[model samples]
Target chain A: MNIKKNFRVILPVGVLALAAVAWAGSPQILQPAGPGPSTASFTAINKVFTGDWQQYGQLFTSWQGGLFNRIFLLILTIVPVVFLLHYIIIGAKSFSHAGTPIKFFGILTRFLHWLAALSFSLLVITGLMVVFGKFIGGGPLVMSGRSVHLIAAIVFCLSAAGLFLIWLKDMLPMPHDILWLLIMGGYLSKKKKPVPAGKFNAGQKVWFWLATVGGGIMAWSGYTLYSFAAPVDQIRQMAILHNLLAAGLVAFFIIHLYMSLFAVKGAISSMLTGYKSREEVAIMHSRYKI
Target chain B: MARMKFLCDVERCIDCNGCVVACKEGNQVPVGINRRRVITIGEGKPGEKSISVACMHCSDAPCIAVCPVDAIYQREDGIVLVNKKTCIGCGYCFMACPFGAPQFPSGKVFGARGAMDKCTFCAGGPEKTFSDEEKQLYGQNRIAEGKVPLCAAMCATKALMAGDANVIADAYRKRVFARGSGANAWGWDRAYGKK
Candidate 1:
């Protein structure tokens, strides 16, 4: 029974994790030199096959050589500032409010929150510099900009893994969250009454999953773009997929930003100060009371 | 310190690799890297003519725009050069080059591409003087010795000319008007299409 319970929780989580890993294996650009100007096909796996895999790999190496060094420096400098600001400034008070008279984001929850924000920022900024470096400064400036972008992307991926671990507990599906989702929309629309929670509300749980799943795709495709050893056709396909995944993340982040900053009144302050009003907690998160 | 340039007369070229050989000897360029090459179009056909090609040393060089490490820059004499000390050998300039002038030292080792090398227009390299290092790495610095490019100066047929673009173009136009039947104004365009 214990094993069964564990499997029930592990199955979806494992699949989501796998999906995330696979998605990150996609590449950005994949033009490769082919055999003697006559052959331009892209093969799978090894040399028994014939085509553009080697060419794409060669191109990838050039891309890496051109940009990785400078990008790494920028990420090393910037991400710590973002991480420290989120953890120390935004998460401190929230942990104290878990079961207090005034409630807000708990310390554990706030840690995960800041982590997600940090990873997302790094990924977005670095990814742009790599894909669009040439299009930006034209000719000479493309080189410096591209290398800065590649290094930041690697840091972003590492941070994303941390964010995933920190939020896995809340992101798992719960019976209460399902019920809350069913009625919460109507309640907010005034067609039904409100339901509350202790640690996380149904709406919050939904947001958590969105970040988790979408982030996985972004990480996977981003990795594939960087690895450089993959076959060219596969890399090209991955590049397209990665672009799509990036678009999805951008849309999701917009909603995320709105909810944290505008839609919910005390959301930003909780991440910033880590506390919420007693009345606010009672009404919004009654089901999650510790 | 005027900007140096090279203008080739496509009409007079005889498909001889004379310029290519002269350039190789003058610069003592390393093997597997051709700073200049003669490309013969219409091979084995009646309307065939071969042109010796190298870097145009463009006023707005594409290689300069794409190097991340700021490796390539134009000299006051208008010759583009790679600062080999700063070059990381990334090969972006190779990809962006329309003329394929950038050659890497790839056949030297197990596909480990070397710093990019291209035609110096006979002005030589980034070194201060005609040191052995400059000779071995970037060929002879004839310009420092106050001479035109060896290939142009040594052309037996006088088919290829190097100097100001205006002077070369004037000579080419005179030839074209004199022999009006067979003249190609856009030789490069005819060679490599806009890709």
Candidate 2:
């Protein structure tokens, strides 16, 4: 590589690394307020509770306990109605099932996808139930809902990892993905237009990355909450991260659900049958050599 | 009219961990979980100070706010208590409490969390007062018995004060006045402002 090109990448990375080291090593920053007696707990509870982040921790707690439930409620109730209005206005892109079908996915791919989807739905439902547990007058039901949420998280992890490996190539950002995004993936209209997309469109790619990579982060943050022995501030940070990312996931999940189930007639059958009709492939996957 | 509260005087606290043991002896909390802990800052160094902290049984307790199962509740007297049977041990309350008052028996990564336990402010839980179920699940219902919590009562130096909020504040104010240093004795200027 040219020296100029190498320096551009290396300089920024070096600066960031040095800054991190400086921040961590500074006696004033994230360092204990002063040298204390050696009598410290393994969890560093002292340093944790008395940090600048405590203020932000309060903000996060409010968002998680108070705001996130309303956010989810709005997503669950309002988002679908919006999609329904879209469906009513633009109508489903119907394709004849009698047409010659092309192999869009194999059985293995279908299994991985369904596993992730179903478990992700379970996670969403159980997590929301837990968030609304107080309003639900929580007892044994909400308690078990937490259990279901954990189990669903584990299952989602396995499927997400598989999907990450299987779909990484197709999900990579292509230059024309910009064009697909600009035209809204040829969605939002009743016109049958050829979209610049390969096996997966830009919207699908965004969801794929979110479901795979974002799901990984969700699992990590969720695990930290589950088995938390971290410094107290870390818990707040992780909770905020987990819940904030969850908000995005929830919105996209709704979009994906409606698109597959109703927005495009016969779209749901493709994953189940591992095939798409010739018309759908032509319109949706215009760049694919069908 | 009596709003229960906890006040630990940093001036008198000696880091003896007596409150910790007293709580364990009285509450019989789950092993490996200390509902009350002494956090010593500047240990072994000059100006080293130890503070005994637990659930202050806050008027608007963060733990109660964040509990997903509504297992944590606050009585009218402001003594926050937890219903152990319903606690899913999701640990959100544990995360929310800056004091580290919430305790979990086992925090292993692969295993499910056991129910959280915390200082019940000696008022016990939702179970009937002094009922066998209350004693079994929550270890004691001292408030109904008209006694101070075991930790504060057994404190040798009287650093840990437990009682109504007004009473504790009055007692602390008298202590500060008796010392004749005004607000400086209590670090009021640093924490709040000069009088």
lDDT of 2 by residue, A1-290 (tens): 46755575467558857854553322222223344322332123335453433655567668766788778888889999998898888878887666779999989999999998899999988888777777777766776777788889999999889988888767777789999999998778789988899999999999997888689779877887776645556667778888889989999999999889998898999999999999888889999876
Model 2, global lDDT: 0.76
In angstroms, give how far residue A99 of model 2 lies from its true place.
4.3
Name the best candidate (by DockQ).
Answer: 2
Per-chain TM-score (chain B), model 2:
0.88
Q: lDDT by residue for model 1 over B1-195, one digit each (tens)? A: 444556556456786788888887767677767887775544565544455667767665657765655678888767788766555445556545545577777422234345678888776677766787777767777778888888888776777777755567677678867875434333323222231
Error of 1 at B81 (Å): 1.4
TM-score of each: 0.49, 0.86
TM-score of 1: 0.49
Maximum-TM-score candidate? 2
Backbone clashes (count) for model 2: 5
Q: Score the docking of each candidate (DockQ).
A: 0.07, 0.40
The clash tally of candidate 1 reads: 42
Give the runs in model 2 whose Cα sits over 4 Å from its true position: A1-55, B107-110, B181-195
Q: Worst lDDT window (10 residues) for model 1 chain A? A: A37-46
**For residue B11, what is the lDDT in candidate 2?**
59
Docking class of 2: acceptable
Model 2: per-residue Cα lDDT over B1-69, one tens digit each: 797777776657899999999899888887888888887765675645567777777656667777877
